[model samples]
Target: MVLTADSYRVLRGWVNGLGYSLDARLIPYLELAGFGSATLTQTFDLQYDLISALVERWRPETHTFHLPCGECTITLEDVALHFGLPIDGDVITGVSVIAEPAVLCYSLLGASPDDTDSTFSKLKFTWLKANFQHLSVNATEEESVCPARVYIMHIIRGVLMPNLNNNKVHLQYLPLLADLHNVRSYSWGSAVLAMLYHELCRTTKPDAVDLGGCLVLLQLWALYRIPFLASVSHQPYVFLLVNRWSIYPGIGRLYTVLIYRLMIEQHTEEGFIWMSYRRPEIAAIIPSSSYVDSQLWCTNAPIISFNIVEWYHGDRVLQQFGYIQYIPDLPMPVGDVHGINKRGKHGQHWRVTHQIFVAVWENRMA
Candidate 1:
């Protein structure tokens, strides 16, 4: 039987495979903001077929894969160990559309770009790259902070929390970066996973042509969890597990979309290393900070980013955490929550708009 358009998984790589280089002066600030472990020096293909296959297996209602072996997922532990990012603390939510985009940009970044397309709330990566690309060693502390913030903003828009805009990023996160000293406290890793989980759910809609929101993390998660799909050799483990495949030779283009779907559908529990992170060497590299909230990795809570809320049902995939893989109860009914987006949400703070989900996260482990 041939596949119809309705049954076919459309493949689309990141439309803009852009790269950015951070200035030496901004390193400390980025480190302070909890993204120092991540690097942007390399640009990567999204491994579209691989991502599409995973998305195809993703169950939106359950937020875990219904693979042949058993239910598994990219856990909060994976987000923490992979990126060395803070997983618990302040929620990264705010008004989706800033009422005064120029004011926020100038106040936080010390400059503003031209509002040519009325997309003022969404700044183009080109404008940011052109202006804040470089910072001098002699720059003042105040002078250095501006470019450093811009660099993190680029990471969010370009890499960590990408969206369909491809070349631009929403300014909702600017307020979060306004106070750099407090930035690291904002669970950047959890936010990345939330954005990714939502994207994985959306892509399963059968008509999604483009995938967004940290496809890199999704690919890396697949490589570690589904060893059969990966074709790389043993190498020294990297700190931010996200950086492990920076120099990887491609394994995606070797197979077609249907072939990849078949490989995943045929996987067995024996082929899966449920304890990949338990390796002593890898466990050693996971920073202590990532463990402060290690307990929350298994909490059935909502992982949230501004204007985006996705359920993180750690209780459902306990086997990934090395616990017994019991058959889970009926997956939580969150189909309505999955339908919500940032559209028509001007002047609304995500905390207020999405408080229902946020409350679930607030009382996590209750």
Candidate 2:
């Protein structure tokens, strides 16, 4: 797609609608790094730089990732050992394993942006194609049910939380456009962004908020097809970010509240679909009604429909924390809503059940 200045604004607004912002410090770093930067600049090369950073930092592992690849049998411990990286009490060092390749991809430019058939795009296409095929196969055959959910969640997670943690075995790389600008500082940011993005955009059974933190890593083969603007460039476009410590979009304890609010809205809705697989107890506490659905679909939530004015209007609670205003309340359905069937291993199932009490109060009527 021709991502123009206007389109960029729309994308930014979409993110802003969800209460996120581009880190001010990041743009300057882009300039300093020799990569040109602009608020609405349209250069696929620049775009590719961001995507490459993400693909580069990619460390393939099965468990330890919020978005685990069910198809892969390798555990996080296995991945660390395979990479010959030190695992200190579940933590991994040497980010260079991911950073170097990202930096290299950040610099490339010169190919025609219209070449949708370029090598990079081809890779992305192939990855997506394979994923689509897998999904189709799993849907057709119940035998692949477990593996299908695992792989599908992995792709969803890659889109959701694409960052690595400080720990060796922990999944990192929350995929955010801004995080992709600077690999080192924003890896976690990116990972969180991935989860947040998918949570906001993709909805099925549960309300968007409960699924907010969910994510999975798509295997490297699954990612090779997607193309970014930077693949055409031959130079690393300098990127920048200030105060790496600050989570620019302001995701923190407060952000967690956003997720809490969403669960409340979904649970109370009529015939609302709740996911009981991973955590049935928590799902049960959502306060079911006949209006809710027993099945969930990957659909967007209605809470996001709130007008900025209606969302921010005269609401003192949100006004107190100015940043809170940035996050708009997702609109709830006017009528029937579907709930999801929960699935996962016994251990995972109980883990979610144990957390029901925490979410139970969330549905209390004022």
Q: What digit string (tens of lDDT, one per residue) describes model 2 on residues 1-366? A: 232222111111011110122233334433322121212212111122222222222222211111121111112222121121111111101211222323322323111222332222111223323332332322323323222222222332333222222011111111111222342221122223223332323322122122322222222211221212123222333111212312644322332223223332332233221221124553354333311221111111111100100011112122211223344333332221112112232123221332332132122221
| Ten residues in sequence with the least summed lDDT for candidate 2 | 303-312
What is the Cα-based lDDT of residue 8 in candidate 1?
A: 48
RMSD of 2: 24.1
RMSD for each of the candidates: 6.1, 24.1
Error of 2 at 188 (Å): 19
Per-residue CA lDDT of model 1 for 198-228, tens digit only, reads 8888877766888887887888888887777
Runs in model 1 deviating more than 4 A are 1-8, 15-18, 115-119, 232-255, 327-329
lDDT of the candidates, in the order given: 0.74, 0.23
